[model samples]
Every structure is written in structure tokens, then in C-alpha cells.
Target: MSFQNTASFPGAGIPEQVSFDRKELSVILSLYGRMVAAGEWRDYGISSLRECAVFSVFRRTAEHPLYRIEKRPKLRNRQGQYSVVGIDGQILKRGHDLKTVLRVLERKLIRAVD
Candidate 1:
């Protein structure tokens, strides 16, 4: 007697995974560390969504995010690939250079002390 082979089913659509590169993470974490030391930030969260990836900073666990660092690969060809959104949902800065994009938040850190 011969054995029969099982049939294959339809393929499922897999969602694209979003992630931050080493250099990108380095730039983000550098700012985050400074904010933490300044006491302006206490907690942080990261999200990898379909269209973009976000790094959220919070002053408190239960409160809204104080800042959001976002990376949208689609925008790389246009305005930029990196963006910083304020708590009010406004785009504080956007540019191709991660360091330049993060300058907006750094300004806040400066005036926060002076």
C-alpha cells in the first residue's frame, strides 16, 4: 500500500515588521539618557507599526507621552525619514539627519534648566 501526500493551503499575508537601525537607536537613546538625567523624562516606550516606528517618552507612567520620536521610511524620499512630535501632536522637527531632527527636543532641555 502507498501513502498519500497532504495538500497545501492558501498562503497568509504577513505584516511587515518595522525596526530601528543601530545608528538610529544610538541617537535616540542618547537623547533619552540626557532627558532621564534631567528628570524631564521617567519612562519610555517603543512601537513598531505598519507605516512607522515610534519612540515615546513619558514624564510619568500614567500620563501622556511628553515627546514622540518617529521614523517613517516612506517619508525618506520627501521631507525626511525622521520626525519629532510634541505632546500636543505637533511636528516639532523633521529632517534627514537624526541629530538635526533631535535638536528641537534638545532646545527644550536647555531652556528647562535656564
Candidate 2:
């Protein structure tokens, strides 16, 4: 079988995978640290897809993710790129500002303390 170098051909036009930049990861990790300290979070996973990137938080490694923070650049103009989704598969928040969108999860930390 023959192989193709689509990845090597710059002009071939493939969608670039999305990922968390350093600044974005810093913000996410900051919240993760606080949540972990609060005993609300235990594990996390990250996915870099062609059209979107996701950061999933888990209460336990063996169970399903408790939350998923997604960045879909394609929706940046329509519904904003950053979003926080609950374990029930509901959108907790969506906004252009990553920090603002993450506040939804941060609020949980407060309730966990109360």
C-alpha cells in the first residue's frame, strides 16, 4: 500500500488539532489544584481533537468523568468556544473568555465547602 504525506503538505489543508495553550492550561490547572485541595476532584484527562479540545475532570479514575471543559474554535463566533459540561452531558456554561466559563466549575468548590 502507498502512503500519503498529507501532514507534510502545508497547502493540503487539514484542520489543525486544538490544544490548551500554556496560558489556558495554567488557568485550568489552577482551578484543578484548588478543586483537588477541596476534595472535589481526583483525576483529569485531556483530549486534543481536530475541531475541539477537551479537559475532563474525574472524581475517580475508574468512573466516568465528572465534568468536561471543551474548546471548539469553530463555535467561537456562534456560541463562544469555551464551555463547561456536567457529567449529565449538560452545558454548564459557555463563553468566549475561558476564565469566565470556568467560573461555573469554581462555584462548585464554594458549595463543596458549605
Candidate 3:
């Protein structure tokens, strides 16, 4: 019995996990910082999955996220890779540009101030 070694190849048995890049995180964090200062958001979470990456914003630590920012590379060509989902699982915005997609949340921040 002979067994072939697969150790030579990196990520041979590893599943790919999608995540936000530095630039992407920069933009997201900028908004998060503003929200935090405004007292609109208090907690956040990040998740990296095989198909997509998610950044969840929470009003409180124990409750469900108020919004979810998702990056699905597979949708890059079809409906754009970036999307913002509301608490009720509705897509608020979707586009190729992260900043543009995140503008939906910014609008809420504006409303909170007034």
C-alpha cells in the first residue's frame, strides 16, 4: 500500500475563508467609529465563511445585530460583491463599491442625530 503525501502543497486540505481586507476594514471601521461616537452602535462582530465575509453591528452586546455588512465575491460580477443587510434580513444596498454600499447605514446615523 502506497500513500501520496500532500504536505508539499499549501492549503491542500484547508477550506478557504473569506474576510475583509485592510482597506475594506478601514472604511468599515471609520463608519463604526462614527456610529460609536454617536451612541448608535455599541458592539460588533466579524465572521469569515467559505462563501462570504460578514461584519455585524449591534446596538447592545446580547441582542441580534442591527445590520450586517457582507462581502460575497461570487456576486462581484452579477449584483456586485458588497451588500448591507438590515436586521430583518432585507438587503438595503448592494454594489461594487464598499463605501457606496455602506452609505445606507450612514443615513441612519444622520437620522439619529436629528
TM-score of 1: 0.82
- Candidate 2's residue-wise lDDT over 1-114, tens digit each? 998765666545666688989999999999999999999999999999988999999999999999999999889899899999989999999999999999988888765334
The better candidate by TM-score, 1 or 3, is 3
Lowest summed-lDDT stretch of 10 residues in model 2? 5-14
Candidates 2 and 3, the one with greater lDDT: 3
Clashes of 1: 0
Show where candidate 1 strays beyond 4 Å.
1-15, 111-114
Runs of candidate 2 with Cα error greater than 4 angstroms are: 1-15, 111-114
lDDT of 1 by residue, 6-44 (tens): 775554344475678889999899999998998889999
Q: Give each model's whole-structure lDDT.
A: 0.89, 0.92, 0.94
Top candidate (lDDT): 3
TM-score of each: 0.82, 0.85, 0.85
